[model samples]
Target: MTPIGEENRGPGLDERITGALVGAAVGDALGGPVEGYSPDQITDRHGGRVHGIVGPWHGDDWRTARPIAPYHKGDGHVTDDTLMTHALVRVYARVRDHLDAYAVADHLVPDLMTNPRWIPELEAEALPLHRVFLAEKWLVARLAYGHVDPREAGVGNIVNCGAAMYMAPVGLVNAADPAGAYAEALDVAGAHQSSYGREAAAVFAAAVAAATAPGATPDSVVTACLSLAKDGTRAAIEKVCEVAGGHGDFES
Candidate 1:
């Protein structure tokens, strides 16, 4: 049994699910401020620390580094990653099943471009679906050939944590089902993220799924994530755990 399996020997199902979603959102928000910063920068700002979601924190310059929409400031507001995760959760609540690439694309891309819920910074970056489709015309062209380039299918917009951060909800919806969450996250993440970026999203999703099981602890959740993540993400998780361990509790 996984560490989560061992921990989840007590809590009710609803409690576990709630814990998983809350954990994901908190993790996303907490990590938002430090996204893409080098370990040195992170250490300098927060004293080589990992923090939980509590109060607002400042993020690095989005314009110079990640290139978010015009309204974006240095404040720690979540990017498209969290927003798209919420969108996926809404869709899953309606359908109560897994989603396909086209289904997620149909909802996320167009919505991000037009939705007022997005902060001004993100809204400004939204591209019309028609433009994205046209730019990736090969996606449609290759539909007949049974092959589509995932990279070409989405608009060439921000490639930061925007897509990955929000993907946690996918794992929550598929709680105790890591494989399913990984597959679904990849399908959606492939459209917007690639390389380490996509891998980070997938690992987060899988961790949420594993953490949703009853009685699961934060430690177990981190362990579960390590099994699936690679490169920077895995290293980040390790750093988070190390920092968490030194602290008395998340509130401290």
Candidate 2:
């Protein structure tokens, strides 16, 4: 890696960054239908593996797993991951630099409400943010309309991967600087997360910053994660990958 720069940088840096962003969107759509299904369940239902775009859940065992409204997901559609990421992207475009929690209330909320954009999976033009999960909607409502403070906006909400999942762009923007990315993600995640979920956002941003660094490789990415992760988080990943190593890649 020649380091991140406009001049005298290594080749393919731009492509890799583009790959990171586009790949996140495409992968989100592909994985949307099977979002909550176990690997075993997916194989059982799809008869080995999913190939092309699939429709909504057809099984009877899935009601409890779906969102309350559950607006016909899958079928080339994306979930909250893409929605939030896109909103954040727009905020970055406006700011043209790093951001913190206040940007969530200022830029993201209006984008979610007024902006009409095409949802790839839904294959329609609407307020793309309308498809966000209820929990996410709550954050926006609290910040934009409920008079909540930006720093305390995430209080009383469920702590989950909702934050960390979409923070890769922060890492991408602050590429090669894991600490800066982690700090920024932590600050911004406060608008929609607390406790472990906020911690996950920091870890994820750090991982992205490290992965997007010039000359980053798969092994180096794992190394970047292990360096920043702590205790059970690191151990759990090691154990899971150990089991995953024996399995062949699915032909999807």
Candidate 3:
């Protein structure tokens, strides 16, 4: 098992894991309506963007994968990020321990290929057939080296936030152990994302681990994210905090 409690321990074991997964899904749905659109665009489209839990979340546009429907325009639909997180959750439910790179690659690569329902709205942007083949090739390479060569792994048109967005669940399973979460997230995310993309995945994973601790508030989770993220990501988090703060209570 990926050991937790190397440092501060927060929640009960089950609660932490469950809370992390639930929180990630909630965050994804909360942000889904605003996905891809800038703040200005969102304001222009909707009189004012709802801060949290807006209703009538719609599927993303096939062409742009941006939320665009009237009234229900960009509300709270889950994305590939949350779907892949569920996939990881399934794997953890089965294994109940840390999985090596090859095992993770075996599960993830095939899922990416055949799981048409994983993220229905964004299927139009799924990896092309050739990239699927390449992913398989890199999976083999990953098996050989115990880690895929970053150069060979992420070379394709499939680059995006897809891999990073779903990574929170991995950290949830390894709650209170930021290092383990970071390591596992890096191993899995390496198959599909690199550079800043990989970094983003790692940060989110770390935050999940932190948030899973008992009594951890949203602000604490955001602080954990700030601790793990790089300058750009930290800046983004700051901006999000500013927006969240300005909105007062999000549920209102």
Best model number under TM-score:
2
CA deviation > 4 Å runs, candidate 3: 1-11, 52-76, 115-152, 155-160, 215-252
Write model 3 residue lDDT over 49-134, tens digit each, in one string: 76776543333343443334222323455654566677666666767777645546666555544555524333344432222223
lDDT string for model 1 (1-252, tens) is 557665647776677767656655566566656666788887777776755432223444444453322324334455434455566777677667776566555554445445546342343534322223232333333332334454444344344554565676778777887777887887777765666667777887887788777656776666677767677777777777777685222221
Candidate 1's error at 62, in angstroms?
A: 14
Model 2: weakest 10-residue lDDT segment is 243-252
CA lDDT, candidate 3, residue 9 = 57
Error of 1 at 187 (Å): 2.1
Q: After superposition, how far is residue 68 of candidate 3 from its true place, in Å?
A: 6.6
Candidate 2 lDDT tens digits, 143-197: 9789799888988888888888789889888888877887899899999888777
Q: Rate the local accuracy (lDDT) of all candidates.
A: 0.59, 0.76, 0.61
Cα deviation at 23, candidate 2, in Å, is: 0.9
Who is ahead in TM-score, 2 or 3? 2
Worst 10 residues of 1 by lDDT: 128-137
Most accurate candidate by lDDT: 2
